[model samples]
Target: MTKMMKAVVKSKKAKGAELQEVPVPECGAQEVLIKVKATSICGTDVHIYAWDEWSQSRVKPPYIFGHEFSGEVVETGDLVHNIQVGDHVSAETHIVCGHCAQCMTGNAHICQETQIIGVDRDGCFAEYISLPAQNIWKNDPSLSWDRASVQEPLGNAVHTVLAGEVSGKTVAVIGCGPIGLMAVSVAKASGASRIFAFDLNDYRLNLAEKMGATDTIHSMHADPLEVVRKETNNAGVDVVCEMSGHPVAMDQGFKMVTNGGRVSILSLPVRPVEIDVTNDIVFKGVTVQGITGRKMFQTWQQTAGLLSSGQVDVDPIITHHFDLADFEKGFNLMLKGECGKVVLHP
Candidate 1:
């Protein structure tokens, strides 16, 4: 008989999920089976849980849906090498075709044929998961499971904040979600002269300060563009890391970024956002980059170095924890935006 495990599954094409017993995934020839230790809720996971328009368009039901996790290798397939059973690991999540044009050019994160672990196949929400060996990221033995699980998103933060030259530059992070909070620290670690964080949530703003935001703006109460402009002597910020998918925030980021500066957007807007291309891009001479997942091994290497060297600390951002069975409580916190990163143990 096949082994079974409990997992949070999007068992239907509707809002909400079910924690059910399902057959444990089998390890493929080039894959490894992991005993999940900790997994964290991401905004993407929340979208899938709510069955929003994006989820409806992209996600198929009756599948396990979580990607950010850390685990111990319990078994490995015959073709798997280097990584052995008992290895502590987290996964990169984005599995790419090595022969794709993007992959051939060191852009595997955006490969033409990319299959995300949770979104494209079975994921680590269960007690065990089978993942391709190439996706497995060996963790530092000393890193806590909570922190290890977050490396995936943290890499997103690192890639966005470090996409351009941030050293000795002023940066404005226009969002205080988990990734934005992580960017605050990444900016600080990268030697930003000053860092400003904007968010409607006072809770997250406070958390941003702890994560090394030189200043925090409550977007609901204050105007971020006006405030950042005044604070920067009316020239505007040198770099804008737009992590909020809100159209208003995106507009504010474009408006607050100085002419000829860089803007790195990591957010996914649910709907179309209008911006004056002539003013926001063409005339201003601003460099705009649409950032996606971590930059394959480059971003992963940086993530590991930053985490292991103690240059970045994600412990403060992990605000809540729950067993997989109590996922609803965790989802409730996420829905209200009252928590930072919520970790789940299977």
Candidate 2:
């Protein structure tokens, strides 16, 4: 008989998922079977749970769907080397096709045939998941499961905040989601002179404060552009890290950045957002970048170093934990935006 494990499955073409028994996946020749110890909720997971427009278009039902996780390798495939059972690990969630032009040119994060683990394949919201050995990132033995699980998202924060010069510069992080909060901590750890965090949610703003944001602004209650000018003395921020997918907030980021400033955008707006290219971009000479997943192994290396050296603390950001069976409670809190990173123990 095939081994069975309890997993939260998106069994319907609608909102919500079901706790069901799924057959343990077969480990491929280049893959390793991980006994998942901890997994975390991502904004993408929320979108899928809500069955939003993006989820509706991208996800297929009846599959396990989550990506951020840490586990011990329980089994290694026949062809696998350099990875062995008992290694504590998390993975780079993007599985890229190596022959693509982007992959060949050191930009595999934007590979033409990139497939996300949770979005394009069976994910980690289960007791066991098999992943390609090439993608495994070994964790420090002393790192907590929850913290290790979050390294994937933390890599995202590291990539966005460090993409440009941040040290001794005024910076703005426009979003207080978990990743946004991580960006705040990253900016502070990176020696940014001042960090402003903007969000409409008071709960998240508070979390941002604990994450090392020099100032937290409730965007709905105050004018972000006006405040940016007042704080920077009309020069505007030197760097803007855009994590809010809202068009209005994103536009404000563009406007609040100083001439020749760098704006690295990591958020995926649900639809195309219109912005004034002539004034906010061209004339001002703003450098706009569309950030995607972590930069393969480079981001992972930075993330591990930061976590291991105590350069950044993620304890405040990981605010909730639940058992695998209690996944619904975590999702409920995520939908309300009342909590930070929610980790699920399997």
Candidate 3:
């Protein structure tokens, strides 16, 4: 009899998720099967559960959804090398086609034929998940699974925070969501002199404070640009890391940036956002970088070093944890903004 594993399955056009027994996936020639240890609820997961427009447009139904995770390899395919069974690991969720123009030019992170694990295919919201061995990143056994699970998002933070010059600079993170919150730690650990975190939610703003944000601005009462100007002594922040995806916040990030400053945007704005391109970029000479997935192994190396060195701690950000069976509860917690990073154990 074939081995079966419990999985969080989303039926076609399904509204929510369900736990079911499914066949453990067999490995492909260059694949490795990982025993999932921990997974995190991402904003993308929330979008999938809600079946929003992006989900409808991109995600085909009858697919299991989850991506941010860490695990231990339990098996490997014949062609798999470098990764061995029982190796502790985390994975880059972006599966890029190596032959694409972007890949051939050494920019594989944005390969035109990228297949996202949780979105484009089945993912790690199960007992086991198979991934191409090239995407696997071995985690040091010294790190806990919860910390390991964070590497994916941490990579995003690393990519954004390190996109341009940040050392000895003042940085304003325009959102305090999980990734935005993670950016605070990344900025602080990367030698930013002062880190300002802005958010509507006091809860997330508070978490940002603990994550190394020197100043927290509640965007409800005061204009973030005013606060940033005042805080920076009439000058704006040296760098603005925009993660809110909100049009207004994006504007504020530009307004709060000093002339010639760098603005790294990781936010995925649904509708087209209007920017004062002529004034913000052309006139001010500001450098606006659109940050996407991690810079492949480059971001992973920085994230792992940060985690391994204990320079940036995520233990405080992980405010809640739940078993895989309690995914709903975890999802609800994330919905209410009741916590920072929430983990699920399978």
Candidate 4:
């Protein structure tokens, strides 16, 4: 008889998820079965819940649908090594093909054959999940499950904020979503002399200040470009971390970046965005980089160090928690933009 567990399943081709009993996933030869302790909602999860264009194009239904989580190893497959049952762990959501060109060239995060756990396969919004052994990241025993689960998105923040030279520089983070808010702390930790955070949500802007943003701009009421320029004596910011997929935010970031400065973008715009390529890039000599997932293990290492050293604290960013059965409440908070990171216990 198959053991059954409660999970949030995208069982239909429409909006929302259903919490139901499903068979526990089995560990593969090189995988480990984890007893999920805690999980968090991400922007990606919200997209799936809403059945948006991206989700319609990418997500196939009748699958479990969460990726950010921390758990304890309850079982290991025949070929698994080094990791034992009882190990506390989190996972790298991007599962990459080792033989791909990007993987061979130290850019596996953008590998041609990469599949995400929640999007491409069964995921961890359940009582248990089976994941590849190589994707498991052992957690510090003292780390709370909520914080441990967030390391995945934090890696995205670290990769974007630290990709450019930030030490002794001024930075403008043009988004206050979870990753954008995390960028504020990452910038301060990495020695950005001054940090300006922009967002339409007052809740998130206030949280950004707590995360070490030197200044916060409520984009709905104020002009971020003008404010950032005036704040920097009209020189503009030395770096721009574009974390909002909104076209306006993208334009604001490009407009506020200093000539010859760097712009690192981690956001995924829903549609084409108009920008003056000649003025924003060619003439200004601005360096633009499109950032994706964490750099295989490199960004993970940096994320761990930042957390362990107390340099970047995510405590304030995690504003809500719920049990697996009450997942809708968490999703409602997410839809309202009233929450930061919402953690769920299975």
Selected candidate, larger lDDT, 3 vs 4: 4
Candidate 4: clashing pairs of residues: none
lDDT of 1 by residue, 13-105 (tens): 999999999999988999999999999999999989998888898989899999999999999999988898999999999999999788998
Q: What is each predicted model's overall lDDT from 0 to 1?
A: 0.93, 0.94, 0.89, 0.93
Residue-wise C-alpha lDDT for candidate 2, range 1-346, written one tens digit per residue: 9999989998898999988999999999999999999999999999999998889989998799999999999999999999989999999999999998999999999999988988999999999999999889998889999999999999999999999899999999999999999999999999999999999999999999998998999998999999999999999999999998999999999999999999999998888899999999999999999899999889999999998889899999899999999999999999998999999998
How do the predictions measure up, each by TM-score? 0.99, 0.99, 0.97, 0.98
Worst ten in a row by lDDT for model 1: 220-229
What is candidate 3's local distance difference test score?
A: 0.89
**Counted clashes in each candidate structure:** 0, 0, 0, 0
Q: Candidate 1's C-alpha lDDT? A: 0.93
- Candidate 3: residue 84 Cα off by (Å): 1.3
* lDDT string, candidate 3, 193-294, tens digits: 999999999999989999999999899878887888778888888999999888999988887889899999998776789888888778888998988899
Angstrom error of the Cα, residue 73, model 2: value is: 0.5
- Give the Cα-based TM-score of candidate 1 against the true structure: 0.99
